[model samples]
Target chain A: MPELRQEPITKNWVIIATERSKRPSDFSVKKEKRKGGTCPFCKGNEGKTPPEIMAYREKGTKPDTPGWWVRVVPNLFPALAKTGAGETHEQNFYLTKPGAGAHEVLIESPEHDASLETHSQQHVREIFHAWRDRYQALINEEPIQYIQIFKNEGSIAGASLEHPHSQLIATPLIPPVVDEELKGAQEHYQEHGNCIYCEMIKHELGVGRRIVAKNDHFLAFCPFASRFPFETWIIPQQHQAGFDSINDQQLHSLSIIVQEVTQKIRGSLNQPPYNMVLHSAPKGHSHAADYHWHLEILPRLTIVAGFEWGTGIIINPTPPESAAEYLREVNTNLVEEKERLSWQQVH
Target chain B: MPELRQEPITKNWVIIATERSKRPSDFSVKKEKRKGGTCPFCKGNEGKTPPEIMAYREKGTKPDTPGWWVRVVPNLFPALAKTGAGETHEQNFYLTKPGAGAHEVLIESPEHDASLETHSQQHVREIFHAWRDRYQALINEEPIQYIQIFKNEGSIAGASLEHPHSQLIATPLIPPVVDEELKGAQEHYQEHGNCIYCEMIKHELGVGRRIVAKNDHFLAFCPFASRFPFETWIIPQQHQAGFDSINDQQLHSLSIIVQEVTQKIRGSLNQPPYNMVLHSAPKGHSHAADYHWHLEILPRLTIVAGFEWGTGIIINPTPPESAAEYLREVNTNLVEEKERLSWQQVH
Candidate 1:
């Protein structure tokens, strides 16, 4: 069984995944290359995977059938299990809990080569709708306090399969990153009676230098203290504390901005690997006034070394102003045309 | 000039290194391979680097010459500089400061291929002495609040050069990670009236399940909540808050334990890339009763992906108990023989 252990000093929780435990010799084997094979996520291989929990399919089609465009299923090798009790205990002064939660994969498209940057706006909206559904479902669970939705786009970004997909992990406790954000937000509210994220958006708008893309409902820009080069964030224009609360129109606008920023990154950097994560208010903080939801996309261009790990301070080589300028200048229309041509060939 | 920018919520400071800024096109270029070239850190090529800040050289040898066994020099592409005033300013509600501090490289040896695990115990002790000397010198700087000493052992671990070396970066403020530790330690001390790390040592000693190596003055173990596979910590048995206060005899024992741990890691894991970091109390708090200094060695065996970035929670695939058992079981004598043979061949 996997266990969640908390460091005594820092209170940072780590999941000791004994279920997928590795010996020293296991690390010596090089990472497996993604070769041409029968992808379990492909349309015809629905039977190869576990039964689908939810999916968007044709009206009369069955659940695990070829008509589904988007699908959600349990992770094959989950980091946390659904059967555990999720009980906490102390042994020898160390706090530990069973790794009990849900790990699911959201297959974005039936097509194996489909990616967020290359997908159509409507298709991307469907992906968001699927994510919203899962978030809503998991947030109501008795033991779940936080639900994390993240996507790793390439092998280097920790994607195990070639098929484009996103992941959702429902955790039993509030994660440290979210807890820190909440504390910061609450402190700001107590001091200034305003959301710090709102202030950040207002400041970025006033400066007009770090803006990458903006629409009526959403804005994307490089954060001033970006931890990675070309790191970008997309925040809702309206005050919203939960990602699941996004309306259809807002989701439409978000899809456009997200796709545009990702396309610019892909085109400008020669298709670098990246990770996208959604940050939202935890379950009971959906109506909090001090919180605002956002999405962060981090490009994996540099290796994080000892300094970063030691100090928790990042040394970003590219300034946010430069990154924003480069991203804003990218001819996304040209990129769209090039992607369309290659996508047609692949089809 | 490079600048330090703090995130509004997390208060994590990031170095916007505009002086060494990169264009979007620059990231498209592959990282430079460590090829055969004029090795700057080698015995005969000391002129390639900046002037020596300090060195443990023979009496007859001049500065930046071949006789130095260990040398310290300014980093060629430093993340922080020594010239600017490290003054804080508020710009558009964001905290900003000049990236003014010091970044230096500590070449462990004149031999091009020597490493911590393979070097003699005496050489390793000299490396620690160099680190302590640099720490003592930098801690007295008026603007400096913290000093970070770390090493990247392989190219994948962010070593740009093949030669074995460590780094020291003095900062104008305490980093977020150290601040978190200090806060946690103070809280624990207030409640328990004891040092948390010392308690951890006592517990680990009592259990004897996660210990990797131990000496008279030092103990090495895989932490209960290790963030990575084979992540090990070498802590002093006695309660010490500052690394710079190490006595000569303690340094000798530390070197022995450190080398033993590194050798076990390299031997058991096939010499995977790793990072070593020294974690000590910030200046002015070096004598705090709560804080204890330790060294963390993180093996870069897995990719930290979207889940970790989103939650600040690590999912370690190896349990600390298993890792400790494997590390403790390694045949260090066999590893020593293999390294000696390789050294002979390289020479």
Candidate 2:
């Protein structure tokens, strides 16, 4: 069984696979260090994967079939599983517990190469729906406290498959990152009676230097202290603490904003690899003024070496103002023109 | 001027370059994307770099000469510098400060390709001395509060130059990561009257499941919460708060143990890219049993993707016990055989 071990000092948890441990030489035999030619996420290869957990399919299509558009399947190699009973195992200074959770991959489109930027807004909206649906479903589980929704866009961004997909991993613990954010948000609420993210959105709009895109209900901007080059955040204009609190209007607005921001990035950087993540309050936490959920898109343009690892601080070469200026000026229409052919094929 | 921008919520500082703002295309024009030729870090190319900040030279040899066995030079493009006055700039929701610090490179050897594993013990010892020497010197500077010493071994590990070198970036502020570590250590000390790391060392020694290399004064092990595959921590056996407090006896032991551990890694994995970092408490706050500084060596065997970025948790495939077992059994003779020829040429 893979056990989650917590580092005493930093309180960081690491998953250690004891049962099926890999040797040093195992890293060298990486199946695909380069391009993955044929993707199992494609339309006809539904049987190649485990049966779908939840998928959007045509009326006549079976569970594991070719007609699904947005499909969720169990990861071939799951980092965490739902099999383990809820238990905490501990030694003197080392803490261990079974990694009991869900690791599911959400195939965004039947087309292997289709991305949110390349797909239609309606298609992108479905992905958001699926994410919310998974989050709501996972939260109902007894042991699950948090569900992390993230996407690795390219090979360098840690996507082994070239296919466009997102991942949802439900964990029994509220991860330290989210915990820290919650603590900070709670602190802010205590001091000022306002969500910090709400203040940030208002501040960014007032400054206008770091605003990348804004819609009726959503706003996207290069973060003031972005850890990566061209790192951007998309947040709801309203103060909703959890992602589950998002309504139909906000979801529609988010779909448009997500597409626009990603389109700007792709058009500007020629589609550099990136990681996108959704941050939300933990389960049982209601929509309060204390916290607000948002999404972070980190462009994997630089190598995070020793400095970043040792110190939590980051050395961002591009200033957020400049990044916002550049991204704001990019013709998202270029992506539209480029996606026209792929869009036709998907239809 | 480059500014240190702090994220208001997390209190994470980022170095934002304001002067030489890299455009979208500037990052694409990265030098030495492939194999480097006529290397500037080579012995004869002394004039190519900024004048030596510090160098260990043979007797009667002048500065920037070929006689130096070890050298330290200022990074041509420093991320942070000593130019800014200590002042804070605050916008509504964002905080900024002057990026006043020191950034320099410690050339490990005169030879371009010589690394710690392949270099003789004597040569590697000098590199450690140079690290301490620079740290001591930089800490005495007025605005410098902490110095982060690190080495990136390969291009994938963020080494633009193939030349073996380590970096020291002194900062004016105590970084958030170190702060969190200090907070955790203090909490541990307050509750248990012990340093958490000291407790960890004792615990690991008692269990012996994750021990990699050990000597009288120092022990290296895969951390209980191993964030990276084959991630190892080299901690002092004796409970000392800081890395700078080490004497001659400990340095000698550290040199051997470092060489042994790297040799084991190289012998078993065929010389993979890695990043080594020295973590120490901030100045004016050390040697008081409150913090225990150690060196972290992270092998760049896996890519950090969305899950890690989003959750601040790592999913390591290899168990620490298995990693330690494999590394412990490796023959150090492999590295010794590879170094014999290089050692002769240098002598």
Estimated TM-score for each candidate: 0.87, 0.87
Error of 1 at B65 (Å): 1.9
Clashing pairs in 2: none
Cα deviation of B310 in candidate 1 (Å)? 1.1
Assess each model's interface with DockQ, reporting 2 decimals per model.
Answer: 0.22, 0.22
Over A1-347, each residue of candidate 1 has an lDDT whose tens digit, in order, gives 22222222123322222223322222222233454359999898899888998999999999898999899999876766666565666655666666667789999998987788888888998999999999998898867888999999877788878798999988777887888888888888898998888888887887877888787788788887766667899999778999989999998878878888898887767677889999999999988899999999998776689988888777766667767777777777723342221212211
After the best TM-score superposition of candidate 1, give how far the Cα of residue A119 lies from its true spot, in angstroms.
1.3
lDDT of 2 by residue, A197-292 (tens): 888777777778878877678888887766666789999888888998888888888888899889888665757788999998888775677778
How much does each candidate deviate from the true structure in C-alpha RMSD?
11.1, 11.2
The sequence of per-residue lDDT tens digits that candidate 1 reaches over residues B1-347 is 22222222123322222222322222221233455458888888989999999999999999987899999999887777776676666564665667767889999998876788889888999999999999999998967888999999877788878798999988777887888888878888898999888988888887787888777798888887776677899999999999988899999888888888898887667677889999998998888899999999998776788988988876766667767777877767723342221212211
Say which candidate scores most in lDDT: 1
Question: What is the alpha-carbon lDDT of model 2 when measured against the actual structure?
Answer: 0.74
- Candidate 2, which segments miss by more than 4 Å at Cα? A1-37, A334-347, B1-36, B334-347
lDDT per residue, candidate 2, B1-347, as tens digits? Answer: 22222222122322222222322222221123334458777888888888998899999989997899899998876767657665545545555556667789898887876778888888888999998898888787867778899999877788878888999988777776787888877877888897878887877877777888777688889876676567889999888877788888888878888898888775567566889999887898668777888999998766789988888776666656667777776778733453221212211
